[model samples]
Target: MKKLILALAVLVSLSAAAQRSQDKKKMDAFITNLMKKMTIEEKIGQLNLVTPGGGIATGAVVSSNVEAKIKEGKVGGLFGVHGPEKVRQAQDFAVKQTRMKIPLLFGSDVIHGYKTIFPIPLGLSASWDMALIERSARIAALESTANGLNWNFSPMVDIARDPRWGRVAEGAGEDPYLGSQIARAMVRGYQGDDMTKPTTMMACVKHFILYGAAEAGRDYNTTDMSRIKMFNEYLPPYKAAIDAGVGSVMSSFNDIDAVPATGNKWVLTDLLRGRWGFDGFVVSDYTSVNEMIAHGMGDLQAVSALALKAGLDMDMVGEGFLTTLPKSLKEGKVTEKEIDQSCRRILEAKYKLGLFDDPYRYIDTSRPAKEILTADTRKAAREIAARSFVLLKNNNQVLPLKKSGTIALVGPLANNKNNMLGTWAVSGDPQTSIPLLEGMKNVAGNGVNIIYAKGANITNDTLLAKKVNVFGTRIDIDKRSPEEMLKEAVEAARKADVVVAAVGEASEMSGESSSRSDITLPESQKKLVRALVQTGKPVVLVMMSGRPLALEEENELTTAMLQTWHAGSEAGNAIADVLFGDYNPSGKLTATFPRNVGQVPIYYSQRTTGRPATSEEFKKFQSNYLDVPNSPLFPFGYGLSYTTFSYGDVKLNKNSMKPNEAITATVTLTNTGKYDGEEVVQLYIRDVVCSITRPVKELKGFQKVFLKAGESKEVSFKITAEDLKFYNSELNYVAEPGDFKVFIGTSSQEVKEADFKLQ
Candidate 1:
């Protein structure tokens, strides 16, 4: 029996290997045959990515004379074009008019969700439900593919600590472990183990290296960090995506070690292709190759050659590759073999997408009717949105608003649908969105009286409002003055039994090119909220924004506060669910909320300084702030729940464990409050002493569980030496034997400590 089993296993392995060899041979033969018929211009054209003029213009690089270029065999791929009809029109031009007859690849920036928008990526991370986050990506793929897009620039897994960076809205928040988990889930949801499926679009893991750790929380700024920091902190999520079989990668706009990522050979070649074994092609961020000229790399032509040698295969929305690669080859600056290699990668992606099988595979005009924004998709969005809403404060249990009350919904966001879908939901329809006023009415039914007022514009500053409107119509200035709007808002609050103040950024206030030095609430909203609080009615603030807004003042005056991050198409319904107790909020803060902008880069995982800021007796010369506290307004992983939970002392199975052995830590948690709720029980580890200084605490494991009011459940986590591993100064990932501290609790800030040792 053993001999027969071994024989069968060997046969199966051989068969799999043979099948892979056959597939590779077939792919190589096809690409070789096609390249033989192509001229240098046609091959170079295959590497160019151009955006069609005027379809969903998110970026500034809409290609000029796009139709003429496609016909001339000067264009490779097209993005910013939507609808099956438009995509088909461009594909037909390429296949019928170009000499090579190569089908054009259609791409879109379908981040977060498509037409059936879900919460922004940061908001989604708060849920900490991997399955739910993956489902959001799945739905996005379904909608985007139905609309004729074969490639999606999505799953931006940049691990950002600086909330002031507007692009944080596009990523999973800090903590590489959590970001890596979310990254894997998103890749699985998108690529789905098969890129050939019509519902599964190819996933592109973006911003190649550390685009998240920008200097001073500035967008597109240079990022400089030690090799150990990259391996241990910011680079894990991108590696996770690659491990999950992500199909493509996008280069970041920022430079690392003073070398632009788009033109950095060490980043694109040695590390990504050599160490990580990433086989996917790298596409430059929008015009990044050309932008390298401004980085003092060289002229446009020189930078283009540098990018090609650096291993960037696609020039996203830049004609740099199209016009310069051929010139560089003629001048002997670049070789034809390099051009052919990149062209082959482009062709390979198309083949895997089944575009070669049928040029119109994703362009079925009928699919949109059945697949886009269906009832089930909207339902999923609502559930996920509700799960994403972090209950920041529920003081006095002011939330779970009673259905019988005459409620006043005040603020510019109260009745606005334009801002509901948030940023980068390019295909989302504002008309289809249900506003908060409608949501309250839908949740409360006919018995409740709901009054609403446009308390203030998203921001009353004229220049700021105009700048924000560059993205969308987020601000609608009333003919009435700010004072008049405040008067009406106060009057509405006075008459109501309770006030639900809808406040925060417009959709454009926290996306790309929208960084804010001062992340505090707009002064106009602050005034309106203070007036409402003076009304003596319990005010519930529904704060909607992408990044965490500093709400120190609102946190004090408001009886309850909810952080609803631009909850997508079903924004109103989901917020209504949490407000009416239909859904118990379990979302935790993935990013820290600073007390002020001065603490912009604050996060939980900081190395222990010589003078640590503890709550012991104050030391004047310690690392303490003179004006504000060193602590954030709310720490990372902090969130409130309607129900209270009691945690028992952490119990460890052993006092020590060998390098290869494991230790089990257990905590007994009871729902001590009145209602049943979900809790995200967190586990943090601290290396007491190490060769290098470690963080004060680092989140290692977490479990999301549900418990009835009085039910107690013991949650156990098995920790091994592998969990203690970190990249040393020598750039080697190692686990040093040492004493360790284990903490288990609801959040990073609140935990029960236990001591253990690594033998």
Candidate 2:
């Protein structure tokens, strides 16, 4: 036994030594070769990363002039150019034409899907299923790599609460714990254990700083927060991605504490590189280095020098580095060592991607044509789309609508294919998508009578119309006027047994650079909805939007509502399936939907003030809004099922526990409604009193339960000291030994609680 243990120990030591040696050898070789052949221009070129001017392209070679650049060694890497053919051609220019023949890396913004569109990032996050989320990314990498693309600018790990932030649709909602989990999931999904595989791509966790907390929920606005606030609330997801071995990071556009994130050494170097120990290359957001001049930081040369010294490895699309880096090097504003360090890192990425082995490995022309948008890809899209739909309101068991009756599908989005693919869907093809009218027709068959009308355009405002038309024509104005469209819709509602009004923002209206001050439904669409409601028909509102909307009035008037935010290729079919009982809606809200725009930035986990308002009387001189309710219209983790479920009392293992010990809390849930359904049982913790003020409630854990009619089951969560830890004023993370309340329920607002203490 002793001999065996010693032998095993020896083997482990040898393996570890071999791994270290291999890594050192690879790094040494890359650095040596880079130093030997690199000219001052070539080294500076390594810091220069550019995006292709046209539509999304991927490959080693994208531009016609790529050959010239490769021969001259004037470029380090290329992004926004994809596909095996283009990548191969580009690789050929570098490997076959250049003296040093350093392979170029390729990247693209494969946010949701490469070809087969899944739900938008926010919609996918609503599922709150980490395995499923990872699988979506895995499939995305499979399709993307198959097309000869290797890097993905995705898993935007920003924590957003404000619905008005259009980019909120691109990240996991407000909680850091959940966001961290999702960040790790996406990293695993994209890179897997081995990125050298044909199916995996390097994961680039983006917006490295606080870009989510843009003021008034506007995009690219100034961001300011205390260091403690950042560490406790916003920085966890990026750290989690680093811990998960993500290959790269992208600096955000927003400034942190009056300094642009791209040029903030405290953020990029002291925090990310030194504290977090992240060894990945840092890429700046699009033209962010140049934009720093507008941000009042400095001139292009000064800002570019600051960015490089601050640890920004790649400059994307700014050309600030290309134009000014040489002068900075000559003036000693930046050193040769810094340039070599950044260049070596870029070379290391290419080496890790196996581009050194064979530059043309991914550039197979046959694969793009064969695998880009196949039938298998569309099937995955349909499944993922169905999972992203959150059933918001279902009264009188109105949903799973009977297919035999006359169904009135009234709205602008009902038959629209253009808006099916939501924001940041660069490669999704809408022509092959299933529109709502066609989907319902296919599902309902000839026996069901379907009536449709264009209730309203996404918006009547011409300015809003132009903004939404940035990518393509989203608001296709109907020939008839608004009054005419409403009349037709109302008339259809009067005749039909049920009405499904598909309304919300056009595709381009709620994405990057698409922030809106007001998040209410467009006036023309609201008028149409009010008219249809007056007809006294049972209405099912199928909302197609990217961001969370303030829909208090719609909630009060409509019979049922479903938030189907850009459901991709199978959107219409998925909606039809749920409406007529083919599939049960299981998605929850990743973001909070507010009652009014005045109640902006409302979320479940928020710190309690000295004068916290727990009830109506506390509002007089407390932290409460004067006109609007403190609560959101729909809280985070809020959703509905066709069936009803009831929660019983929470049972704790013990009334008291030690600091290092753990306890179990269990709750009994009974499915009281007719159909078998899924329910997300949420567990929230409240530190009744702490050294520092704590949130009213923090989501500690949750479970998704499946039960049949009249069936009951118990769900339990294990509590740990780590789960209770929070950053105090001294910036130390520790769990205070005190009274803690555990609340378990369907949503954050509605819950049953029990108190416990730690000794």
Candidate 3:
């Protein structure tokens, strides 16, 4: 009976494979036929992606006369235009008014969430929950497709170690293994099993190459790294996204090895398509193709030709392809075959979307009310926000405040609605967001008496405020003096039994071009916190920022600290839930919190030095800073729950294993403290000997488990030689037979170790 069942399953799998092969052949034929009917001008048009001036433009350029271009068959796709009605109007021009009647592909930057917003990508990574992350993407897809958007430029899986880059808020932090896992989840959630479904949208894994490791922690700066380092440390997440079948890729603005990503043939063709086997069409980042000219590549015609040859199929918000491709083709710099290939790729995408059959399928006017921002979606957002918050400190058990306490909520963000939704939330409405003060009132009701005061502005610097307020009035300068605001806050703190100070960066402080040299809290908020801390009342600091902040002083001064990365739409409700003990925080830090800005680009997986700094004290002739400790304020995978967990010594199933054989590492985890909670059991592996130097410890696996008070459970992780593989000097992914050390515990810094070997 078992053999019969196995045989049946094998037959079903073969049948599915055969069906997929046939479908691919059919899709190819359809695209080939469509390409034959298209004119040379129309083919080039299909490669051009433009945006109308409707939504937020990340760059300065927005296409003019968009309606005429669509009607004249000069435009292929559009972004920044959403809503079923508006999208239908644009689609009508392409399908109903154009000669060939090709449907337009609508894309949007649905980064973290759609209408019902969730936490930023960095905060979502802190949860370390693949299911929750995937669910968030799924919700974003559902809401976006309902609004007639078919493509999402999301799942920014760039591994960022530098918080000063600002774009770190938009990605999974540091570790390639963890970043790769998140990349897969996000792709699965956005695309699902079928692309033809109306509920699913194509996912574009973005910033194609390393845009995160910008020099001087500046946005769009040059990135230079060795190929081995690229493969082992930075390339996994992008590879994982492609392996998960993400439909599109966006080239970054930065250059790699002196060649801009948008025009690098070795990167786009040789590495991505040849080595990794990524079949998706690549799209240029906003005006990235044009920016290559500034990178000293060449003239517009020269760069545009280079990009098309480099496997970039779409030009986003740049008319480089539309304007220069024809001349380049005529001048023999580019061939018609190359143009046809790009045209074919775009047409294939439309066919996969079932656009050829029904161009207006996603334009149902009734979907917005039924699918967008429903009660169920908002509830999910609230729950997910609570889980993303990390408890950095809780001295004397200051958190989980009593419902009957007289609480003072004072800070710039406490009652503000403009900054609730973090950066790149293009579709979310800030006016609909619930403020911290309002959320506390709703949750605490009559049991808690909550007093509110405007402690200080988000920042006192007018120049910085103006730069941040480009999108909106994010950091509003109050007419009242800073001293007056501080005085009001101190008075409120004195009257209350406990104080909850809401402070941190404004929404625009850590995204896109918002990089900062100094990553500490603004002096205005720092002074506000200092005053509140001196009131002799237990102060619970609810810190909100998009990236890991330099919080050494704040952590030392505050009674309790919650690192909430601009929890979106339901942020207020979620913060209230955690503060009142309605939910226990299960989030762990994805990025290391630096003690100071001097320790920029700090991460747990640093290569072992000849003379390593083993302690906080600086040693002469060692790799240590004299003024400050080498340690971070909080290490990666570090978060404190309301309850406590203890791990027993690691027990191995075997001492040695072959390349194919698996070894099991087991540890008994107990909820030692008095509350039920979830703990992320992290597993790190160290290569005792290698041809090339490796990191002291690399994250291999992790498991999040829930345990009741005093309950003990045996947790196990299976390891094979595959888990030990790394890119060597030759850029070959291989695992050497040698001794290995395994550490299993709560975070990177705190763990228990055992030994193993590969034969």
Q: Best TM-score goes to which candidate?
A: 3
lDDT of each: 0.90, 0.86, 0.92
Clashing residue pairs, backbone N/CA/C < 3 A, model 1? none
Please write out the lDDT profile of model 3 over residues 1-759, one tens digit for every residue: 999999999999999999999999999888888888989999999999998874324422234478778878888899988888788878888999899999999999999999999999999999999999999999999999999999999989988999998999999899999999999999999999998899999999989899989998899999999888899999999999999998889999999999999999998999999999987788999999999999998999999999999989999988999999999998999999999988888887888888898898788899999999888998999999999999999999987889997999999999999999999898999997888998898888798989999999999999999999999899999999999999999999999999999999999999999999999999999999999989899899999998989988998899999998989999999999999988999999999999998998899999988999978887899999989998899999999999999999999999999999999999999999888899999999999999999998999999999999999999999999999999988888899999999999999999999999998
TM-score of 1: 0.96
Instruction: Count clashing pairs, candidate 2.
Output: 9
745, model 3: CA deviation in Å? 0.7
Instruction: List model 1 lDDT by residue over 1-759, tens digit each.
Output: 999999999999999999989987998899899999999898988899988766335532334478788988887788888788878888888889888888988888888888999998999999999999999999999999998998889889898988889999999998899999999999999889788898898889988889999998888989999888888889999999999989899999999999999999999999999989987788999999999999999999999999999999999887899888877898999999999988999898998888888888888889999998999999999999999999988877888998886889999898999999988887788889978888888888878889889988777788988898885678878788999999999899999998999999888888788788989889988999999999999999999999988888998899999999899899999999999899999999999999888877889999899977776345687887777888899888888888989899999999999998999999999999999999999999999999998899999999999999999999999999989999898988889998999999998989999999998
Clashing pairs for predicted structure model 3, backbone only: none
State every prediction's TM-score relative to the real structure: 0.96, 0.96, 0.98
Candidate that scores best on lDDT: 3
Error of 1 at 121 (Å): 0.7
Question: How does residue 62 of candidate 1 score in lDDT?
Answer: 35
lDDT score of residue 70 within candidate 2? 63
Tens digits of per-residue lDDT for model 2, 55-155: 33443345556456666777777876666766776667767787678877888898888887888888888877888889889988988988888888988
Name the lDDT value of residue 683 in candidate 2: 92
Q: How far in Å is the alpha carbon of 27 misplaced in model 1?
A: 1.8
